[model samples]
Target: MMREILYRLKDRYHFGTPTFQRDDLCFVTVKRDELRAILTELRDVEGFTHLTLLTAVDWLEERLFQLTYLINNREANLTLGLRVMLEREDEPGATTGDTIHDLWPTAATYQRELNEMFGINFPGSPRVDEEFILEGWTDLPPYRRDFDSLAYSQQTYNDLPGRKTHDPRDHMKKALYPTYLKEAE
Candidate 1:
């Protein structure tokens, strides 16, 4: 069953590689532009009706963000992973492909999360550009690979009162030295 879908995708689209991870799971890497058409075909024709998950991966070294759409064909008990890559910088750019919100309204939430967390835009998704989890966030997207979380936290949050900045290992060794000496004596 998975092989049939693989062959169908190969015949119709320019997919990179079709990998069967298991008896019921397959993955295919595709270009960003072809994402919508492929997803539409998968949903409408391939019996993959459930958009189980949508997420992003930061390929910091390659300066690319890979968006993964996991869809499930409930009838076949099979899952297909569709992946597309885009430039990581979100500088008022367009969506890589058509938003799948029409097929799965739940996609809006995932798209919104990716928009806020990784700064990936989903052009046709309603409220995708709007804030999803964060409120009044003025810094870089927190989930981006290049984001400096420690610096952001230090600048945004106040330090706890009487909290000393010391290495725990060193502090522990110092505190145990006298006890060791007493034991030896």
Candidate 2:
């Protein structure tokens, strides 16, 4: 069923090959310019009524940001994830994406969050510039692969009073298999 749909749209949109992750789920990469049109057709004609999510992945080495728009056809129990890649810029606020809030109002929230977290601008998205999670965040967007989380914690937070850090592997092993460690020793 999903393959048939992709075959029909493939000729028209020239999107990348459909990658079927499951019987009900498929992902296809679409050009940034064609995303809005493809999404419109999916919603209006293909019976994909729900916008499940809109999320971004920062590909630091590739210098790209992949935006995935997951749409669902509740009646058919099918999900289609459309991926669009945008060039990642060195300067913050340089990478931009089209706002799909007009298609799905919930998309505005996702776009705002992406703008705040990944430094991906979604122009014309409602409150895209406003802080969605981080307030007064002056450093690099926290979600970007380049962001140094440990460095940020070290710089921004002081050590808690009488707090001791433990190695995660040892802590997890001790918590889950206390007797196993004693037996191994």
Candidate 3:
């Protein structure tokens, strides 16, 4: 079922082959400019009515952020992942894409979360500029792969007075194999 749809989209709009695929799932990587159009076609023509997931992954090494939209067809028992890549760095307008909230209202929340976490802009989403999970956050988006969790945690949280940090391996070796530690020393 997905194969036919992929072929049709490829013929019509020159969509590429699946980046990764399995028996019940297929992932197609599309250009940022083509995302909304392909998704609209999938929902309107392919009977993939359910937008199961919409999220972004930071590829810090590649300097790219990959946005994935997962859609499902219940009757066919199939799931399709539409992926698009965007620049990680903030350009003149920042890395933004069209809002699909109109197609799937729930996408508003997902877009908001992505905006809050990854700093990916969605120009038309009502809540995209608004805060989602994090309120009054002044730092970089917490979910970005480049976010320093240790630094943020240290800055945001106070250390408990009695808590002692220890190397887990050293503590485990001392406790579970005292004789081995003694012999090694």
Candidate 4:
């Protein structure tokens, strides 16, 4: 069934080869320009009505960001993941994606979070420029591979009073097998 749908749409849209991960799940890379139209057709014609998720993956090495839109057909128990690749830009707000909030209202929330976390802007998305999770965050987006989390933590936070750190292995050995080390020695 999935193959038939792909075959029908292959001529109309320029998409990459379909990769079937499972019997009910498939993934395909779709061009950025055709994403909105393809999504509309899938929802209206292919029965992929539910937008399960909209997420982004930062591929820093490749200098690209992969945006995946997973849609589901509840009646057919089929899931199709459409992936769109966007060039990763160093400057915040440079890398942008088309807004699909009109197709699925829930997409606005995901786009907002992506903009805040991954620095992938979705122009015209509702409140996308506003903070979603991070408040007053002027530093690099936390989810980006280039973001230095350790440096940020060290600079932003101070050690708590009387805070003691322990090695997990040693602590576990002492707690669970106190005599095992002595016997081995």
Clashing residue pairs, backbone N/CA/C < 3 A, model 4:
none
- Per-model TM-score on C-alpha atoms: 0.83, 0.95, 0.85, 0.89
- lDDT for model 2, please: 0.93
lDDT of 3: 0.84
For model 2, the superposed segments whose C-alpha errors exceed 4 Å read none
Q: What ranges in model 3 sit over 4 Å off?
A: 19-21, 90-93, 168-185
Residue pairs with colliding backbones in model 3 are none
> Model 1, residue 96: what's the lDDT?
52
lDDT for each residue of candidate 4 in 13-110, tens digit (9 for 90 to 100): 99898999997999999999999999999999999999999999999999999999999999999999999999999987899999999999999999
As a whole number from 0 to 100, the lDDT of residue 100 in candidate 2 is 90
How well is each residue in 1-185 modelled by candidate 2, as lDDT tens digits? 88888887887896887889999999999999989999999999989989999999999999999999999999999999999999999777899999999999999999999998999998899999998789889999989999999999999999999999999998999999999999999
* Candidate number of the best lDDT: 4
Clashes in predicted model 3: 0
Error of 4 at 49 (Å): 1.0
Report the candidate with higher lDDT, 1 versus 2. 2
Candidate 1 runs further than 4 Å off: 90-97, 164-185
- lDDT for model 4 comes to 0.95
TM-score of 3: 0.85
**After aligning candidate 1 to the native by TM-score, how far in Å is the CA of 69 from where it should be?**
0.3
- Give the per-residue lDDT of model 1 (tens digit) for 50-146: 9999998878889888888999999999999988888766453333535889889999999889888877787879987676699888777788888
In Å, residue 152's CA in model 4 sits off its true spot by: 0.6
Q: Taking the tens digit of each residue's C-alpha lDDT, what string does model 3 give over 14-69?
A: 55567656877988788877777888888888888999999988898998888889
C-alpha lDDT values of all predictions? 0.83, 0.93, 0.84, 0.95
